[model samples]
Target: MNQQQFSSSHIPGLDRFWAVIPAGGVGTRLWPLSRAAAPKFLHDLTGSGQTLIRATYDRLHPLAGNNIMVVTGQAHRDAVCDQLSGVAEENFILEPEPKDSAAAIGVAAAVLFEQDPEAIMGSFAADQVIGPDDVFRTAVAEAIATAVTNKIVTIGIKPTYPSTGFGYIQKGEKLEIEAAPSAFKVDKFVEKPQADVAQRYVDSGQHFWNAGMFVAPVRLLLQHLQSNEPELFEGVTAIARARVAGDVTEPMAEIWPTLPKTSIDYAVAEPAAEAGDVAVIPGDFLWDDVGDFAAIARLNPAADESGVTVIGETPRVYADDANGVVVTDTSRVIALIGVENIVVVDTGDALLVTTTEHAQSVKQAVESIKAHGDDDVL
Candidate 1:
């Protein structure tokens, strides 16, 4: 993929920051194109010639230097190592199975805290598409500054429109910190709202789309997890301790799955926000989680006069009047006649046909296929 570079030396106070990448999830909504064996983060959904995780590494390595760790499933360990040559073996935290973000991030915090007492860790998803490097770098630099003051800081995307798919972060009082002048106290986190409610939030100018990105001192996170989720904290901490002692193979296998299956939002962010210990950095950049084909359509390059936005096999797709997204990894010609807002994903083993309106329900289709006992297709 084409990439832009940013100089970390120019930024202030990013020296002690370490980037933690949580690379899990199969991205079911973009199914057929995104599968179990090779998940979405492992693919170049943007047709940028670089996979999502690789792009994430490229974005963060300069800022964090060699202090980057990728927490991913064991099934993807080899691929993760292959793609990230700069990341050392010790920096790769391989999970036996999926335990969601809480466990994935918790372990990294615990380990980093032990390694460097002054370490501040920033946790970013491997699959998010970030636009405008300057904006992202500015936001992250301010976030790191805020985190040094011992606050759990999350970057909130400035809402361009009322989006019902993403959760909202309600910004409270403006913080008076010079390092992070644009930071504000997070009032509360609202779950993905109804259309009307989302519109109201947009009108109020107090809400930003939750991007699930956080920066905090490793000490702060470990302490919070220890107080709020003692059992989980104990398990992951034990795993980290075992790693420090040299053999984590056995303890990680035992403790990882035993940790609770929940998100970091539910585990820490909500409670911390209630206590006024969380801060929000207003992110003024184009960002997309790329949750479904509809989101992918918007991120793709603009469509031709015929109106179809195409990715992958661009030369093989012929659009007459179709006006949505068309993705193909196969050799067959994909001809779109008159379909509007439709999604056609052509893969070798299976093909998916749906509309942007119904793209979120494609997960249901995967379930239906599984119920029919076609594991091979999945």
Candidate 2:
């Protein structure tokens, strides 16, 4: 609830930790409420009173202190700065355009390496909702400890269900790290699979949901990046060098767009795992990406006794035998009668009405809107 609450740190090597937040998704699956101008990270979807990005920063600040770095797109610069008040301007790495996670995290590693070669950088996406602060921080501390051994580390969430939506990390054996007791060698990374395969993964008890939270020493991360993607590594390093020398405007404009587009998982994590250089720490905490209306429904409490969840400043909503989620940014009164598992989001310019079962189809709707040249709403 307050910064002072999470300020104390007893974990070793936490002083050298640098938290890197990659905030670059459009979140098209949460359309209407989440758009190009304002992505899901900018919204408080969980009714927690803090924006997702702000909450993310709050969670990481205690571990990293003032060493938090946020890498985001150029378009959301002012909004991001407004939300993260105390973060230094120099700590914000603004990409001229979106180049996916590898470029964003790669450049941040390069920049932090220049500032502190011993920096232990942990990359967490800006939009994920993880909680019971203590548990999450503990896993991260273990990740930091494992990273000190010059191995790439990631905090994998202990699976709660057979979720076909998330990628899986197959943890191999216990890694003997004195500082990180729960560290395990990552055997392999698996793509999102069918329901039966997901069930098998969950049943095995050796697999964890890949939360995309990676921790590694800056120098080690750069070495893997250079080894795996030499061109991308070179480009990001040049931009980092330019920033240290003077203005990064020229170098960023020239190099950033040309960098190869890929995710850190594909570029470094998978390959590193194959080489037995990656470790996974099981995170026993609640986690969610808040991906769509269904996730929004899961995070918020029901409004009144009616089985409907309401968010934002909707004046009033009448529901009779209806169960669903409603997000309204306007004053319009909404009434639902006899409908089940419905989702209604009303922004001034766009209104999205869908069922929980059809939540993932919102992306298709967004694509149709784009095809119709409705960029104004987007």
Candidate 3:
């Protein structure tokens, strides 16, 4: 709960680890800038002018060095490589097809295990923004120490509000690991709940926002895959075997289709709760998934009258607006005279006008674009 209480100095024998970033998602939620060809992670959403993937690589470089492996689809392989030129070429694991996070994790684990069977793997998303690097590093260090002796360890962010967008982890009694004093046994992994249910969870003071960051030993994770999801394990093993046999391209294409499109949460974390093999460490650092335009708006400096402006080619003019986000790419001047709680996005080819209340539903607009068969606009 406090700084001294969550320090990582107590953890000894922590393994120096590698990081796996799953950058293959087609982020439809962040459309216009995000498309099937170039997803959100490839875009510079920060307005600070850095692509999300580049920022993530910079953040991970300190602990994992050039050992960061990026698993992406064949379509985005070139773009991913271009963005991550600082990383070694061999570190990019190109998936021949997309099969969600489970398969991505499997591929990275297989590759890492082949090199160092005892290696601890820390996995992250390509589209997240975590601040206060020292705090994040400390949490990761604690997670690595915990994973070396546990089955799977996850970094859990303290819930700041009743958020419906994220999954929640129910915290159990604190576990006294040798290195970290604040690790808790995971009781349950709940999916996105309804508003009232989410409010109850927040009131309980025993829940955390599941940040989807995980750390685990290669062997232990492989064991869970073999025992629980054998089909996926077999597919992953075949891919690893093919890589060893010098037929790298054929195996990923062959095995990706066979693997189920499930998330690590449904396949591993949820099951681990029943098996009592999961632990949660409180992450006190500032973290956000940057899942939508509103989340991006929250990161910007607050303006007068609850207005947030992202300056670009077209300057934003807002008046008497409260809790609104305005973005424009066209040079055309746009002004909101009396609008409140609205999202006004002006692109040359397309324009998005919605309320902040429906920010998450922007994915529907992306679908509409796809339905119109306008891939360029999406």
Winning candidate number (TM-score): 2
Over 94-129, each residue of candidate 2 has an lDDT whose tens digit, in order, gives: 989878899999999999988889888999999999
TM-score of predicted structure 1: 0.95
lDDT of 3 by residue, 2-66 (tens): 33433224444343488899997777666665667778898776676888888888877766766
Model 1 lDDT-worst window of ten: 1-10
For candidate 1, the lDDT comes to: 0.88
Looking at model 2, how many pairs of residues clash?
0
Residues 1-378, candidate 1: write the lDDT tens digits.
Answer: 112433445444478899999999989898998888888999888878999999899888657889899999999998989999899989999999988889999999999977987889999999999977667877888898898888999999989899999999999999988868899999999999999999999999999999999999888887888878899899988999999999999999888889998889988888889888899999998899989999898888555687788888445888776788888888889888988898999998999999999999999999999899998977
State each model's C-alpha RMSD to the native.
2.5, 2.1, 3.1
Once fitted onto the true fold, the runs of candidate 1 whose alpha carbons sit more than 4 angstroms away are 1-13
TM-score of each: 0.95, 0.96, 0.91
State the TM-score for model 3: 0.91
Error of 2 at 220 (Å): 1.6
Number of the candidate with higher TM-score, 1 or 2: 2
The global C-alpha lDDT for each of the candidates, from Candidate 1 onward, is: 0.88, 0.90, 0.79
